[model samples]
Target chain A: MPDTVATGPGPAPSGTALRELTFGEAIREALAEEMRRDPRVVLLGEDVAEAGTPFKVVKGLVEEFGKDRVVDTPISEAGFTGLAVGAAMTGLRPIVDIMFGDFLALIMDQVVNQAAKIHYMSGGKWKVPMVIRATMGATRRSAAQHSQSLHAWPSHVPGLKVAIPSTPYDAKGLLKAAIRDDNPIVFFEDKISYAKVKGPVPDEDYVIPLGVADIKREGRDITLVATSSMVQVALGAAAMLEEIGINAEVVDPRTTWPLDEKTLIESVRKTSRCIVVDEGYYRYGITGEIASVIAEGAFYDLDGPVRRIGARHVPVPFSPPLEDATVPTERDLFTMARQMCNK
Target chain B: MATAPNPATTGVEAGTPLRMYRQMIAIRLFEERVNDLYTRALMPGLAHLYIGEEAVAVGICEALRADDYITSTHRGHGHCLAKGAAPHLMFAELLGKEAGYCKGKGGSMHIADPATGNLGANAIVGGGAALATGAAYASKVLGQGRVAVCFFGEGALGQGVLYESMNLAQLWKLPVIYACENNLYNEYTHYSETTAGDPVARPAAFGLPAETVDGQDVRAVHAAASRMVERARRGDGPGFLLLNTYRFRGHHVGDIAREYYRPKHEEQHWMAERDPVALHAAWLVSEGLADQAMLDRIEKEVAAEMDAAVEFAQNAPYPDPQRVDEDVYA
Candidate 1:
C-alpha cells in the first residue's frame, strides 16, 4: 500500500523519468530545502559549514544560507551533540553531524542521556527537535574506527527514532521527515551507498513518513529484509537468486526504530521464508530483531526457517579481503537465501 | 562603547538589595532544607548542594531580567532559587510529587523552570555549556537581546564540549556568558588535579573578554555580571566569567566522608572563614545597606518560606504509577 516502487528492474520507473540524485546529494538537498522552509533550522559539526564535511554533503549550504545558519564546529563530538540538545530544547532545529557512526561512543552521553532522555525526563514538557546525522557502514576501507554500522545503538533507546535510508529517494524523504520530527532522531547515511546509490528523487518537497517499509522487489519465494545500504545488497542477491529460479523479494525498512513490521509480516506471510541481511555485526544485532519479528508474527506461515545474514562479530579490518569477509555482502545474502530456499 | 550601569544607583531601587538579599537567603536555606530532607531519608537519590556558591547565582541573576536564560549544573538549587523558581514546586520535584515543576519526573539534578528562563540543570559535567550556546544563538538569530548565562564548575572545563561550545559562542558573537563556578573540586578529585593552564585563559583562548570574579562577594559578581550582560545585550559578544568559589558540603548529599579526599580542616576553613552567606551578611551590616535586625528579618522570612515549601511538598501527591509508561515519545 506504500507509494514506494514495488518491483525494481534497476532504473526504469515505467513511463515517467524522474529527476535523479545520488544518496549524498539527496541528503544535501534535504538539508537546504528544510533550512529554506524553517528559519530555526541550523547545521553544525566539524567542517560541516566551511568544508562541507568529508563527504561534501553540506557543500554550498553556508554560501546560500550564510555562516550563522550553517555552523562549523570544532572537533568535539560530545560538545556539539550537547549543543544540539540545548539548541533544540530552547528554540532551534539543529542537524548535528557526528562524522562517523563509530564516533557515536564519544557523544553517547549527549546523544543517549541528554538529547534522547530530556523529553521523557521533562515529563513531555520539552520536545528535543534535533537530528543527529552520522555516516555508517563499511566497504570503503576506512578501517576499524571509521567504518561501522551502529544504528542498533540509538534504535535500542526510547525517546529516539533511527532512520537508515538506502536509496536517494528514501534518503531525501527520511532525512526531511527526521528534520521535521519533534522528537530526537538519528539519521544514519550509508557511507558506501552515498555516491554509489542513485535514484529518481523528485525536486518537489516530500517527506516519507518514518516507520514505513518499502518493498523494492516483488516476489513469491522468499522475503529479504534489508536496511540502509543493505537494501542494495539484498536487491543484488535477489537478482542472483532469479538466475537460479528462486524469486526473492527485498524490503527496505527506512526507519529502524519504528520498523514497519506490518509490511515485513505481510511479505513473510506471503513468501513463507525470510532472511534479514545487515552490514552490522550479527550477535544480538538488527538481523536478529528482524528475524524474531517474522518468527513471532508469521510463525505458521513460514515453510522455511527465518534465516539471518550479518557481518561477523569483530572490528572491521583494513584489508579489502578481510573487510569483505567481515561485512556480509550480496554473495552472503545469496547463500542465506539459497539455504532458505533449500537450493 | 556603552557605559555599564552602576549597580547600586541604577538597577537598585529602594528594595532591590533587600530583595536580592532575600533571594540569596532563600537559595541558601532551600539547599540546607534539601540537605536535611535527604539526610532524613525523605528524599530519594542524590542532590548536588549549592551551599558556598550562592553569590554567583544571586549576583548574576540579579543583573538580568526574567527573560534572560541560565543553564545550571548538578549543584543547581541556588541557581533555580535566584532565577525565581518556586521553592514549594522545587521541593515537590525533589520529592517526586506530581505537583513538581517536572511533574515528579526530573529530580534535583534535572529541575528546570522554563517559564523563569532556567533552561535546565545538567547532570553531565559540561552538558549545559553547548545548551547555553544554542540558547544564546537562538537569541542572536531571533534578534532578541536576551542573554543566556551558563553556570558550570571547574571540572566542566576539562570537558572538550565546553571548549567547542565556547569557540562557537565567540565565533557567532552569541549573547551567552560562561559563568564558571570554580568550587575547587570535580567529584572527589581536586580541580588542580584535572585542570590545565588557566580556567580564565581557556575562554580567553577564544578571544572572549574573560575575567575571574570573587564568588564570595555578591556585589562584585553583580557588578561584573552587569557589565557582561550589558555588552551581550548591545550585540558586543559573549563574555566568559570564572567565579572563584568553594562548596561547604560534599559533591552530593550523601558524600559526607570528607576526610578521605580533602582535609576536614580545608572545608572548615571555607565554611567558617570564606562562607559567602556570612561574608554577605557582614558586608550588609558594615556597608550600612542593612543592619543586623534587617538581615535577621530577611533570614526569618526565608526560613518561613522554606517551611511552607517543605510542608507543601510533604502534602503533595505522588504521580500515578500507571503514568510511568507515558511521556516517553512526545
Candidate 2:
C-alpha cells in the first residue's frame, strides 16, 4: 500500500500520497467546493436534498446552499434533464444526479435529442453548461437493471462530453471542471469506487481540465489503458506484473468522449505493446474505439496485436459470483498483460 | 354569421399592424416555398409544414419582445420566421447546407436562431414544455422580466413532461406560457383518440389559469397571447392557452399518401373553408384596411424574397468533412 495521508490540518507536504475516502465523500467535496466558488452553480436530483442524496455525494449541499440551489426533484429524468439543459442554456450551471445510470435509457430523448444537440443545433448561440452525475457498477445485488455501465451510449453522441472518475482526487477536480464547463457533460461514478477508493483532494477550489489523461504508474515494457473503476484494477494488475519482470505503464483517461488520444498513442508508441481494460461489454465498447485509434494512428510502433480486456457480452447477473465473473477483474488484466509481454 | 368586434376599435390598439402583417405574410410564404421545395426534391428530409398554422406563430410572436424566449415544435418554420430567423438560413437548413442553423447537422426538424431569441425547434414531442419552464425559472432567478413561450401540440398533453413542467411552473411561479396548438391530430391518430380529457383541463388541474382561443383567427390568438404574456411579465406564474386549429396538410410533406387516417372531406373542409391566411386576407380587405392590388404586391414581393432564399440555399457550401468533430464541446 502507498503512504496514506489525512486530508485535514497537518504538515501536508505533498509529493505522492494515497488517501482513503469513499467515492461518495470525494463527489460531495467536489460539489461543495464548486458551489462555494461559483454562485451560478446549483444541484438537482431525486433525493439529493434532505434525503442526503441517493449516493450521499450531495449530503450537506441542501443545508449549505438551501433548497433553492440544492433541489430535490420528482422522479422525472426527462423533465428535470430538459429543465437542467434550459437552465444551463440561460447561464445557470446545473449539476443533475440520476440515481442509477440505467435510468439514462429512459431519458435518452432529453440527453441525446435535446441537451446534446442544443449548442450545435442553435448554431453556437447557446451552450448547455450542465453535468449529469450517476452511479454505475454492480453492487448490493441491485440486479440487471441498476448495475449496468451504459456510458457508451452517451459517448456515441456528439456535443456531449463524458467523464468517469475513479479516485477521490479525480472526483473533486473533474466535478469542479464539469460544473464550470460551458458544454454539456455526463459524469459517471462507479458504485464500487464510491466506498473502495480514496485519495488526497485539495480543500481549495481546483479543476482538472477535460481531455487529459493521468499516468497511474510509469513503466516501459507495456502500456495499460483503463478508465473509471477499471483504472484501479489496472493499477492492481500492474503491481502484480512488476514481480514477473514485465513493467506496465497504466493510463486512466478521466474523460471518455473527447478522449486523450495523444497521451494514449504516445505511451503506446514507446512501449510497443498495449492492453485496454474496461468494464463495459467487448463489442462496440470504449476498448474497441481505443484499439482502432491506436491501430490506425500508431500502426508502425506496434510490435503485436493490441489486446483488449472487458466484460463479456452478457447481462449483469444478480448473483455476486456471476456478476464478479461478468466484469473484468484485476486478474484478467494481469493475464492479458502477461500474454502480450510474452509475445 | 356574426361578425367579431374589430380589435382596433377595442381601445387595446393592436400592435404595429404593418409589422404583424409582414410577419404573417413572411410565415405564409416561407411555408409555401418549403412545401414547393419539398415537392421539387430540392429540400432533404421530412418537413412538417406550418402552412395553415401561420396565425398561431404570428400572433404569439407579436406578443413577445426581441429579448423574450420561445420553444418551438417540429412544425417550426413559421415560429422561426415569426421570431425573426433569416429566411435564407432557414432555407439553407432545409436544403442541408453549411449555411443552415445547425450547419446542416439538423435539418427541418431542428432549426434554431438564438440571436432572435428563438430556442432550437425540438424534434421530440412535448420536449420544449419543460425547457421553457426552466428558462422561465432562470428569468426569475436573474430578475430579467422576460417570459418564455412553449409551442407544443394537443398530442403533447399525453407527455408526462408537460404535466411536470406545468406543476413546477405554477409551484415556483415561473414566467412561462404553455401554448398548445391543438390541431386535433398527433400524426395519423386524432388528438381525441390519444388525449383522455380536455387539453385545457390538464393544465388547469395543475392550478394554472387556462383559456381556449380561436387559433384560426390571428386577432383572437394575438389578444389571448397578449393577456397571457402580460400576466407572465407581471410575475403571475404560468398560463396555458389551447388554440383550436387544424393542419391543412398531412403531418409531413410525404405524409399525403397516409390519407387513409382522415377523410378527404375533412382535409378539404379545413383547407378550403377554414384557411387561416385566406380568412385573414378577407378580413383585412373587407375591413378597408388593405386593397386587392396591395395584397397582390405583397404576395409578389414575398415570392421574390423566397426565391432569393432558395437560390442562396442551393449555392451554400457543404460543411468540411475534416471538421466534423468540431463544436462537440465549447
Q: Which candidate is the best by DockQ?
A: 1
| Model 2: DockQ score | 0.56
The whole-model C-alpha lDDT of candidate 1 against the native structure comes to 0.85
By DockQ thresholds, what CAPRI class is model 2? medium
- Highest TM-score model number: 1
Put down candidate 1 lDDT per residue, A1-343, tens digits, no spaces: 1223222332334565577678888899999999999999999888988789888889899999998888887778877788778778778898998889999999898888788888867767778899999999987888899999998889889888999888888888889999999989999998867777777877567888999998989899999999887887788889899999999888988888898999999999999989898877898888898899889999999896788878889899899999888877888889878887889
CA shift of B101, model 1, Å? 1.4
Off by over 4 Å in 1: A1-17, B1-15
| Candidate 2, A42-118: lDDT as tens digits | 88888899987666667878899999899888878877888888878886888889989999987788899889988
Quote the lDDT for A35 in model 2: 87
Model 2 residue runs over 4 Å out of place are A1-22, A298-303, B1-19, B285-304, B311-323
Estimate the TM-score of every prediction: 0.92, 0.90
Q: Score candidate 1 by DockQ.
A: 0.59
| Tens digit per residue, CA lDDT, model 2, B1-330 | 101112221221326544456567777878888889889987778889888888898888888887788899999888888777788988898888888888887788888766777777988899898888888888887889989999998878888888888888888889999999988889899877888867777888989999899898888898899999999999999999989888888899888775678888888899898877788888888988777876767667777888888899989998888867666667
For model 1, residues B1-330, the per-residue Cα lDDT tens digits are 111222222223422565567667778889989999999999989988898888899889888887888998888888887887888999999999999988888898898877788888888888888888888887888787889999998988888888888888887788999999999989899888888788888877789998789998888898999999999989988998989999888999888888877999898898889888888888778888889977887687778878989999999999999899787877
